[model samples]
Target: MARTNPLQFVQQVRSEVGKVSWPTRREVMLTTVMVFIMASLTAVFFALVDMAIRGGLRGVLSLFG
Candidate 1:
């Protein structure tokens, strides 16, 4: 088993972190807006689906009663 020197490991980690591509403000804002829009649409869709199922179950149960 080869052991890495602690000092060399710290330098390697710093170099890798510096190489990361950070997103610009505009890019971050656009991505956030898109996520919110998709989330809202998903919520609405699920709500409608749930209401439909509840209504169907109630109607079926009413018939049995």
Candidate 2:
């Protein structure tokens, strides 16, 4: 509701930023690698599921046709 002055806003932003515990470069890199690995695994899992579903549909349709 109350407007902060420009200088006060800047100071407040800096103080809040300073309070944050930023990750180290190594930690960031490790987490990034883990994320990529997990994403790849997830994609592979979905791809397999999709192939299974498609194969099942094709088999069922062939039986009727």
Candidate 3:
């Protein structure tokens, strides 16, 4: 592998950073809110599934007990 000098590395990093399309504050906030909302929905979905499974297990066990 080739080694880059510290100055050259810094310049390359700056050039790459300049080429990035950064999101605006509003876009970032909206995306963050969407992520939280989706995460909460997913958690609720899993919780309901878990409850259903547990209830089914208890019902089956009660029949045998």
The models' CA-based lDDT, in order, is 0.99, 1.00, 1.00
Which lDDT tens digits does candidate 3 get at residues 1-65? Answer: 99999999999999999999999999999999999999999999999999999999999999999
lDDT of 2 by residue, 1-65 (tens): 99999999999999999999999999999999999999999999999999999999999999999
Say which prediction, candidate 2 or candidate 3, comes out ahead on TM-score: 2
Best of the candidates, TM-score? 2
> Compared with the true structure, what per-residue lDDT tens digits does model 1 show for residues 1-65?
97789999999999999999999999999999999999999999999999999999999999999
After superposition of all CA atoms, the RMSD between model 3 and the true structure is 1.2
TM-score of each: 0.85, 0.92, 0.89
Those runs of model 3 whose alpha carbons end farther than 4 Å from true positions after fitting are: none
RMSD of each candidate? 1.3, 0.9, 1.2
- lDDT comparing candidate 1 with the true structure: 0.99
Q: Model 1, residue 42: displacement in angstroms?
A: 0.7
- Candidate 2 Cα outliers beyond 4 Å, as residue runs: none
